[model samples]
Target: MSTPESCIVAGQLAELGHTSLYDLLEQACREYADKPAFSCGADSVSFTALRSHADCFARYLRHEAGLQPGDRLAIQLPNLLQYVVAIFGALKAGLVIVNTNPQYTAPETRHQFADSGARAVVVLDKLVPLVRSIQPQTQIERLIVTSLDDWRQPQEQGDAADETRFMAALAIGRTLPEIETGRGLDDLAVLQYTGGTTGVSKGAMLTHRNLLSNVLQAVSIIKPGEVEYGNEVRVSPLPLYHIFAFTANCLASVFTGFNSVLITNPRDLDGMIADMQRHSITLFTGINSLFVSLMAHPQFDSIDFSRLKWVNSGGAPLNLSVAQRWFERTGSVVREGFGMTETSPVVVASTGNTPYKEGFIGQAVIDTEMKIVDDQGQELPAGEPGELLIRGPQVMQGYWQRPEATAETFTEDGWLKTGDIGVIDEDGFLKLVDRKKDMILVSGFNVYPNDVEDAVMRHRGIRECVAVGVPDERKGEAIKLFVSLHDQNLTEADIIAHCREQLTGYKVPSYIEIRDDLPKSTVGKLLRRVLRDEARAQVQP
Candidate 1:
């Protein structure tokens, strides 16, 4: 395998000189103007065109919307050209970009908007109703809406009425005033939310320096000339809101000036496979669930995997069965890595030629310091499973507006306590054993039990509720709820119905277990571990 020195280029790429992501993309545009920057189905945008469009959008945000630097602009749309335009435009205009899941319900969307204090929102048409429903309760003053077919259509075939409305919203931007631009490398770039063990979703304050450092750190891992500017092709099926894909796939592609094939709807397996067959993707990054699902697809066997030079798996543990199957089918190993949203998401990744380990999460990236520590915050010996503490430039400054939580997450010496139980082998391979946090990962997305329990407790007929993760064949783990009802006549169906009203699809419990009482400690704290154990035992033969 090539060492880190072998991957180091003599000089930085032209894009590397920019302080902000926007400047970086603009630099690429000047250097590789004719190269394709983005593609979706048959529609494509060149680096030069993308830069011009981004400039127009940025000008629209500055002149029309009255937005300024450091202001938060919430983005709620699937992966597409607009997603890129909006993201780069906001960054270029000196705005803090707050990513929102397009699939979020009204309540979920409201929480993010309110929490982030976003003043503007760019939403897809299908999600406009959800945004409009919660607009009154949010701080959003400007709303811009776009449809899936907005950029892909011929001008005559497009919805002129809807386009006029969107342009009017952009025109309203002129009446609003702009703030002075003073955004710095240390200023917040993205407010990426992460579900903590306490079940509270806090925004990780990733600064421009934090993200830039991660991008550089990742670039150091790739061999020079292996993937060049504008020539590399990346397949990004993961949601752009996810920090893993946001940095590795989206921003990385921008840095390298690659043609990023944006998959707007990854759930359409047949359609996604068809796209893969059409494009000769060079770098493919995904989670275990995604790989497993793709392997299960009937058309998956027919796709050409020989062209794929790099495959990375993260977000969740990669299963041995899936890895073996993938390697046998494609002769390419899925390089497993590990990171958290708080870390600007890239910590460790296995190299292109490294041997595949069944459960190891590779070694720390260049210049990253990682150590395993015991519960008391003392460093542990190698091979001992404990909490992982990381110190790196990519680590976020802290949780936004959360001083106490932030203080608790970091050590006195400045190491970030990752809240993940893992062990480092003598050779430096980190193997994750379990999560110290009670957070359940459903299909690689965090599902906090406390959040669900809180929603369930809000039900009038519910006395108490406990949420636990149960093993699932599809999703890595599914939430199983145990409830104690105030009324004896209250049924499981009724309880579930109430939960569905307040929670997102993944947060809603899949299985409802009725219990007279739950196991609690002497201090009255719920014994969630006991419940999880019981749930696992029940599923076993």
Candidate 2:
């Protein structure tokens, strides 16, 4: 058992070998083979069963599907047992896994599939139509679809029937071409897509080493003496496609041999509470909104919180009022963290038992260097707000197919410019003041103003448009649009209706303002700060 300070100074936090994740699972299976590894409702997968299933699927992908090393396989399934099995199987077969959100539309899915040059896709049956519509436009040559009931028994069967449709798909793939095995520690494992501040989505190439490094760094932060390995229970409700959950919840749990209770629909708070009670969950990882919702739920008071040991929050800033109320009720502190899609998504986190500062995002992780720089890229002294830059083993290799964009993201000295405005205090804790770019964070999802403006400008009646974020009580911040209409007769409803068709639900503007002209800079660039100030003035009275 080692202290957090000792672990940080020891510099033992680095990338694990490619085989380390699997080897840890083997050890867990050997020790606790009959113990549950994952559970959902009445369905459960034991450590032994999960490892055996992963091995079977890995062999199937290598021998039957003809998938070779470096081949890309896009996964568009929700949180389920198959999601873990597919990801581990693909990695074991030496294939790069590209994660796609199940909520993506046909165009969005096509763009990622085509860009990654993926040869095959594994998706849910409900989303098969979205994939089928995009298949003609993508390079995907094979499609494997699984139903929601593939692993669950039918109502008439009374939960006793074994649904083997999922297993059958793996068997079919195994009976089909033999592919070469190319497993290596330094091989590429994941291509995580991120929407840059410029509103362009690029794939950040993450190798096995990059992911392994993040997992080791996260493990080091948790005081080993405070928590026991193999006996700890974790709840993972965040979407697995996002890198934040992929590393902290999924990979970290696997590395420590903990039982992870997966929640497919986290919005079902009542069901989540039931699962928490059943498992006596010790560690819970989620975003700010999730914690807020859980605390506000009427049934929240019924759940016993004494068994909980750790609570981790990320993706967005935590609300101070919510944190205080949560601690009052649960007797546990919410450990806030910060990171992005480029750094394997875990750069810093607060200690589990420490008293939390309202706005600080904690100190840098082990084996990582962080500095704040001005617009000219010169490092700034402490207590000054500047762009945060980071360099570490967990940093991504580069963006896929966009060498120019990749080069611009990193500095000449190889540090990754995070585009976040923050200041470091004397204690090394960083406080985020604002974002360098005009990216709006609604709840926890990143919403680019340019993406909304682009969609709004497509309307025939709209002449000019700009989007900004305004403070909101529930969502942290809500999207607000300022527009000049080409046709004076057009109303705000008309503009919102047009945007709804082109943008996602979260990206649509919640408030609309009509203006004859917008403020601009000497270079004719839109001054979003002026618009934000105008919005603030209207609410001050």
TM-score of model number 2: 0.90
For residue 447, give model 2's deviation from the true position in Å: 1.7
The lowest-lDDT stretch of 10 consecutive residues in candidate 2 is 155-164
Candidate 1 regions exceeding 4 Å error are 1-15, 154-182, 224-228, 353-356, 488-493
Per residue, candidate 2 scores C-alpha lDDT tens digits across 22-105 of 555666677778788777666788878877677777776666566678899898887888888887777767789899988775
Give per-residue CA lDDT, model 1, range 446-487, as digits (tens): 888888888898887888888988877566678899887788
Candidate 2: segments with Cα more than 4 A from true spot: 1-24, 153-166, 173-181, 353-356, 487-491, 522-524, 536-541
lDDT against the true structure, per candidate, is: 0.79, 0.77
